[model samples]
Each structure stands twice: as structure tokens, then as C-alpha cells.
Target: MELFARSEKTRVVEEIGGVARLGELVRELGGRRVLLVTDPGIVAAGHVERGEAALRAAGLVVERFADVHENPTTADVARGLAVARDFGPDLLVGFGGGSPIDVAKGVNFRVSCGGEMSDYRGRATATASLLPLVAVPTTAGTGTEVQSFALIADAATHQKMACGDPSAAPKIALLDAELTLTLPPFVTACTGLDAIGHAVESAVTKPRTTVSAHYARAAFEVLAANFPRVVDVPTDLAARAGMLRGAALAGLAIEHSMLGAAHSLANPLTVRHALPHGQAVGTMLPYVVRFNATLEPATRQTYAALARSGGFADAHAPDEQATEALATVLIRFLRLAGLPVDLKPLGLDERALRALAGEAAEQWTAQFNPTPVDPSAFERLLNSAS
Candidate 1:
């Protein structure tokens, strides 16, 4: 086994009432002017107002930029950047789901680095310093707060851009499970599955380091045990807290190992159909798992072990049986969450499948899949998901 260099840095402060700490966090960061990035839904949920109050109480000048969309477009980032420039915020507060958090990262990069979104398309792309950022997740999914990357969509093409740099990582992450209680059932389901997809993809990626695998395995265990419980009882704060921690762990996993074809395939659905990122990825996860199972026996065994440890199968089960059991458990969970079990439900046709497959093949994550997945292979996976 080859040993790869590991660079991991995440400051995640989590609790049931972490939002209350926002005031002190801003003071610690010495931020007087702040920009809060979010969406209308988050504002309606009152998280934005709560965050604003915390900042203001801490003696910071707070500006609200709530125009972030479901799948954040480049224009959204540009608009937020314009606000940041106008406010000259000493700090940025990302206060919602992944879309807003991602947009905040992009805004920070653009405002400080002085470039278009396309200029920093790959890893470690920040050429200049960035303002300090704090992330507060209203949703339990996406874990964007713990990552050093941002996914911004192109305005004209709707293609999600994967931009990464150390500068994009938030200086602090505040995870308050209380905020997640207001999430609707469908949103809970989709985001939970997104966390599972992250763990699974991280486990089997070509760049899977020991550190990544550790985080992935822990994330998988947390999600596997708690996601169903949360779906069954949405008001369970303990279950919600578990899911939040799981999502954060998965985020840490992906930050190191990256993701795979599931994410690659999921991006196009958001681009074309406007599907939620979690729902799109959850729909493709089982197929990606089955595809990855065909790799080396050791790889398959590792995945199976992860599955069994996560309670997807009995510990005594054979690797093949365990793998199949894991896939079945995932599919069942998705169905119970009222998510689309097939592409047909999502209104995907053969032509769209081909287009998405071609698009998936070009994604940066596809290259990291343990198995060599080409456009044709992705097409078959799309059909299988359908």
C-alpha cells in the first residue's frame, strides 16, 4: 500500500444550541463587519434573523445576502461577492444548507482573490488571502461547513463548478441541532441520504487514505443507525444530533478522499432537472455501490466490512452477501424517505440519461472512483438507477 500525504483541518463546534455561540465566535475572530449568506427559506425559518441578532449583539455590522438558490449559480456568487465588496465585511457567515454555504465560500474566494469562478476550477486554487468565515448549518446535511471546497454552478450552462482551496475552509463551524428540527420530512430524508453517499463514496475512492477511511466509516455508522430513526421521528433531537455529526464526519471524509461517480452523476440532475443535490445523489448511490463492488476482492471486502459495521448486515455474513445487504438497506431507506427510487419517477428519459452520463464522465469526482468508470459505464449505471 502506498502512503499518501494527509492534510486535514476542520474546526467544527457542535451542540444542541451551538447557534448561541455565534456572538462569541465573531468576537474571537475580531469581525466588526459581517456578511450573512443564505436563502429565503432559511430566513423564513428564522435562522437568518437569529444569526443576525447574535452578530449585532456582538457589536458587528451585519449585512444579509439571502439570494442563494437551490443549486447555487455563478451569478449568485457574483451577487454575494458584490455585497461583500460593498459591505467590506471582515467576516462571512454562511447560514443555511450546502447551497448557501458553498456560495459563501465562492464569494469569499472571488472578493479576495479577484477572479471569475472559472479561474479556480481545481484543487488549491486560491491565489490570494480570504476573509475569515464562520459556518452555521441550519440543515443536517451537506456538511459544507467542514469542507475546503465550494460547488458553484455556471450561470449560462448550469454546470456545477467544483472549486477547492485551503482558503475556502471556514475558520469555525457551528452546528446546532435545534435548527434542524424545523426541516421538513422530505428535506431530512434527502440530506441524510446525501451524507450516506458521501461516506460510501469516500470509503471506495482511489485516494482513500487511512484517515479518510476512518472518518468515512464513523460517518457511515452514525447515518446508518440514526437516519431511519430521524425519518421515523423527525422531532427527535438526539437522532438529529447524530445525523448532524454524521454529516460533518462525511464532509471531513470527502475533503480528503473526494467523492466518486455518484456525486458526478448527481450534479447533472441538479443542473438539468433542478433536483435537490441530496435527492439526486441518493438516487444514484445504490448503482454506484453495485458498480464499485466489482473491483478487487480486498476492496469489496473493505466495503462490505464497512457495511456490516454500520449495521447493514450481520457480522457473520459473507462479503458478497454483506455488499448486497448494504445496497438493499440503502434502497429501502431511500424509499421509506419518500424519495424517488428510479429515474422514471424523476422524469429522466434515455436521452437525458445519455447526456447525464456523458456529463458525469467529465466530472472531477469520476476519476477518483476505485473502478475505472467511463461514459458507457456511467450510462449503464444511469439505466440501472432508472
Candidate 2:
């Protein structure tokens, strides 16, 4: 048997009113000058004010940088770097969805290490340790709070870059379901599906191990049970908590394992069409599940196991039958979320599929997909979706 080592170094605070405890965490991290990273949407939604009030009540000096936008890019990081440099903060607070948190991570790297975002594009590229950071997520997706990766896109090329290092992981993840209660129905659906995609893809990626599988399976179970309820009843706090924690578990899985072709396909759609990341990935997952199952017996069985865990398939069913069941469940979520399952609804046609395939082949996550995926393979997958 092969040997594997797993590490989860971040402290997690899971409770209903966890954000109110930020003062205690700030003092523990020994933070003096603090910078809160967020966006206009979160500011308007009042989450940013609540977080700012918590830090202030802790008797800490606070500065707010609300310049971040969705799908943060090189320019956004540079803008954030300027603020961090001027403020000279010892601590950074990421207080929004994935975009703000990712920008916070990217800015930390540049402000501490002194380089462009692309300098640390791949894994472990940072030369020095980043500042102590805390994540206060307002959504239940991306799991960037727990993961050591910072996904920032290039401003010019619009290609998403994966910047990762051990130092990039948050020192603390503050999960408060109260912050997610205000999420609009569409946002809830998009982010929930993104979490589900992370769990589904991480389970069968090439780097998956025993530990990663444990997190992935647990995430799948929670998401399958609660994602629909939260989407249908936005005020369900219990269901919201389940989705939030499930996203974090799936994120931990990605930290240990990584993702697959669904993410690879989703990125190009986001870059080209400005589609939400969750919707893009969710649209492709059902097809990717079936695609990998046909070619990889191990992945087929893994999908089967996931189906059995969700109680949607018999434990003794054939790999193909189990995989089909899992795919059906994924489609059921997509449909319930009112997301399109095919490329045609997105205004793309058969003629455009080849271009999208070529772009997907260039994504870094594509290399980790269980079945070997070339542009030709992606062409077929896209066709299947159509």
C-alpha cells in the first residue's frame, strides 16, 4: 500500500453566532493592525458592518478594503496590496464569499512576499510566511476559508490561476450560519452546487487518499440532504449550517486531493460567458460523472459508493448502475436549482464546443482528472451535455 500524510492546521469555529467570537480569536492571533477584505455587495448586505463592529468591539484598529469584485483578478489583488501596504496590517480578515477571501489571500502573498500574483501561480511559490488571516464566510461555497489555495484570475487573459502554499491557509475559519441567511435564492443555489461539485470531483481525483475520501463522502451526504431544503426555504438556518459545513469538508477534500474535469470545463465558461462558477460546474458534473465512469472502473465504483452513501443506490449494485444513479441525483439538484444542464441554453452551439474543449484542456485541474482528458475527450463530454 502507498503511504499518505494528511494535515489540517486551521482552527475552525462552528456555531450559530460564531462571528461574535471574532474578538477572542483576534486576541489569540495577537493581531494589532487589522484589514477587513470584502466587496460592495457584502457591505450593502450589512455583513461587513457586523464584522467590522466585532473587531472594533475587541478594541482593535480596523481598516476596510471593499474594492474586491466577483472573479477577482490581478488588478484587484494589486489594489488590495496597495491598501495592505499603506495600512501595514499584521492581520487580514476575509469577510465575504470566495471572491473576497481569495483576494485577501492573494493580497497577503504580494504584501508579505513582495511580488505579482502570478509569481506564486502554482503550489508553494511563496518565499516567506503570510500574515495571520481569519476567514468569515457569508456564503456556503468555495471553502476557501479552510483551503490553502488562492484562486485569482489574470486581468488580461481572464484565466483563473491557482496560487497555493501552506502559509496561505487561514489561521482560523469562523463559520456563522447567520451570515448566510440573507443570501438570495439564486446565489444560494449557485454556491450550494459549487460545494456539491467540489465534493463530487474530489472523491475521484487522482490524488485522492483515504482521508480525502472520508471528507468527500461526509460532504456529499450533508449536501445531498440539505442543499434542496435551503434552496427551497432560504430561511432554514439548520439547513444553511449543513450546507456551510459540507462546503468546508469538501474544501478540505480539495486541500488534500484536488478537483477534476468538471472544474476544468467550468472555468472556461466563467471566463467566456461570465456564468456563475457553481452553475457552470453544476451543469457539467452529471456529464463528467458518466464520462469518467465509462472509462475508469475505480471512479465508477467511487461514484457508486457515493450513491450508496446518499441512500440512492443499492450497496451491491453494478458500477454502471450506481454511477447512473449518482448522475441522476446530480441532475435532480441542478434541475431543482433551475440551472441549465446543457450548453445550448447558454447560447453556445455545436460549432462552439471545439473551442471550449481546447480551453478546458489548458486548465491545470484537467491534469488531475481520473481519466486522461485531452481536448478530444472534452469535445465528446461537451457534446454529451449538448
Candidate 3:
């Protein structure tokens, strides 16, 4: 049976002093022993300290797990599990970008479900109850805060595993623009682009529904308008809040609609070339948009609608021309963010492209792409991007 389950129950707290409300959330969730999962980078940025302080101020016992790294592997989850086991936490706090949030979910999965990460690589596989989680994002990307999916790679093979379960969704998403104000310019650009990619891809994916499209459209408009401002003026609280809210909405869209080829293509680049996830997706998005719009009428219309939301498409233009205009606009955002527009700049050659294309074809998200993509088709797409 086909299912269309949307996570509208994840309470979102969006305000300038939103992190201050964490104390109330902790009390309401009845959390006595809490586990805070984060990375060293977030700790250095002082966001982790602020989060810990919030929990401590709530008079809750807090345990810290700061061993998570970028593109977290299963080993990272095991490390977190070790801490969780010792802490016996009733609530888990994911305190950073996608990596820490995903790591927190991974640890919770094993702690509650009693298995290795490989046991739950696909969707709706978990039968065990998951611990309540609160997501505090310091970066305005990855929408992991609002989605139930966790991207944990294999420690040995570096192949990413997308684990999803209805129970894995965060119980609350705390969006405080103040936390994002300290983001470096490069991170702001990369994460902002990642949010935009999520909105764009989710709008045209196979599972897109009317509700999902609404969230995606709102995400696209807000991110498109405020991304440059947030990147250029990091201290602009309004722009930062717009990006944070937009990213959360994109995440909600992903929960309902899932993602498509860009994410599938981006994963291989991150695993093979150690490219940043946002950078990989952002660079390849324009090409993917063009590829899908050319081959699918529904996707072309969706792209045209998204372009109209951003004021980039002509209402009277042909679908192909409108979609092309959308792609051109995406390319402009990538260039403005100081990201490469092609794979060659990342030191990838034609030989490497063939291997990456094969991996991209096998990725689970590729099946959800509007247009079917085989290894040969991926090669063509890669060649175009090159």
C-alpha cells in the first residue's frame, strides 16, 4: 500500500529568543536525563555551550556527546550510543547542522531499536519506539530537524545509508536566528544553497502532493529572496530567521515528498571526493534541473511554477524555456555563493565521472527522480555539468 504520511506534529518554535524556550520544552517533554549531541566545531562556535546552558538552567541532568564528525559514519553513531547508554537519557538534543542531528537520530535508533545502522537503511523499517528528540540547528541547512531521515555512512565503504522511520522525526524544532548569526560567510552560502536545493528538488519529486508543494513553494520563495542577504550580511536577524524558517519548511517538504537526483548525485561526491554535501548538491542542481525538465512535462511545469515564485520565469514562455530560465537562475546563485559550477573544478575527470555516475544510479533517491536515470543517463548529465 502507498502511504502519504506528513509530520505536522513536530512542534516548531520560531522566534528571536527561541533558544530561551528550550527550558520550557524540556520541562514539558518530562525529560530528566538529557543527552546533548554535537560536534567540536559547534562547541568552538559557542552554540553548544549555549544549548547546554539552556538544558542546565531547566534543572535537568545533561550529558554531552561531542564526537560526531562531518558526513557521520556508523562508527560515529556507535560512539554516541556509548555515551547515550551511560547517560540513560530520556531526551536527545541534536545541536548543530545535519551531521550532529543525524548522528543523534542514529544513536537513538540503535539505543531504542537494538540493531546496527545497516539493519535500517531504507524507510519505515523500525518497529521500536524512539527517544524524544529536540533539534537546535546552528546552520540553516539540511532540514534534518524536521525530517525523519538520517544519512549515516558506512565506516568502511563510505556509502551513505538513508535511514527513515516515522518515529525518528524530532519532537520539536527550535529555530533561533541568533544562533545562526555567527555563521561564517562560506558556511552561510553552502547551507543556504542546500536549503534551496531541497525546496527545488522536493517540488518535482515523484511523491509531491499539494501540501508538500505548498511547503516547497514557501521554502523556495523565502530562501531565494533572503539567501544572498543572509550570506552578505550575517548579522541581519531578519534574513537569518527567514533562512532558518525556510530550511525547516523545506525539511517538512522532504518528509512528505522526499528528494531526487541532486541528492543522489551529491552523496557519491561527498563519499568519493570528500566534497561538502551542500557544495556537491548546489553545483550539480542546475544540470539536474535541466535534465528533468527536458524529459518530464510534470516536472517542467513544477520547475516553471517554482521559477515564477522566485520571479525568474516568464509566464508566457514555453516549458523548456521557463525551465532553462530556472536553471540559469540556480547557476547564478551557485556562482554568487562562490561555489563551482562544474565537476572539473573539484578535480574530477571523465574517468572519475563514470564511477560516480554508476554510484548515483544505484542511490535510492534516484528512483524518486521525475525522469528515470540510468548510469548512461547520469554520465550524460555529468558530462553536461562538466
Winning candidate number (TM-score): 2
Tens-digit per-residue lDDT, 186-237, candidate 2: 9999999999999999999999999899989999999999998998899989
Candidate ordering by lDDT (highest first)? 2, 3, 1
Q: Return the top candidate by lDDT.
A: 2
Clashing residue pairs, backbone N/CA/C < 3 A, model 2: none
Using all chains and alpha carbons, the TM-scores for the candidates as numbered come to: 0.94, 0.96, 0.95
Model 2 clashes, total count: 0
Worst 10 residues of 2 by lDDT: 1-10
lDDT of 3 by residue, 178-252 (tens): 989888888898899889999999999998998889889999999999987886788999999999999998998
Off by over 4 Å in 2: 1-7
Which lDDT tens digits does candidate 1 get at residues 1-386?
21112344557777787787798898898888899999999999888888888888887788999999987889999999888888888889999999999999999989989989988888899998888889998887787888988988789987777888987888888889999999999999989999999998899899998888888898899989999899999999999988998999899888879999999998888777888888888888888888889766766887798888987788899999999888888889888898777788776788888999999999888999888889999999999877
What is the Cα-based TM-score of model 1? Answer: 0.94
**Whole-model lDDT per candidate:** 0.87, 0.90, 0.88
- Which pairs in model 1 have colliding backbones? none
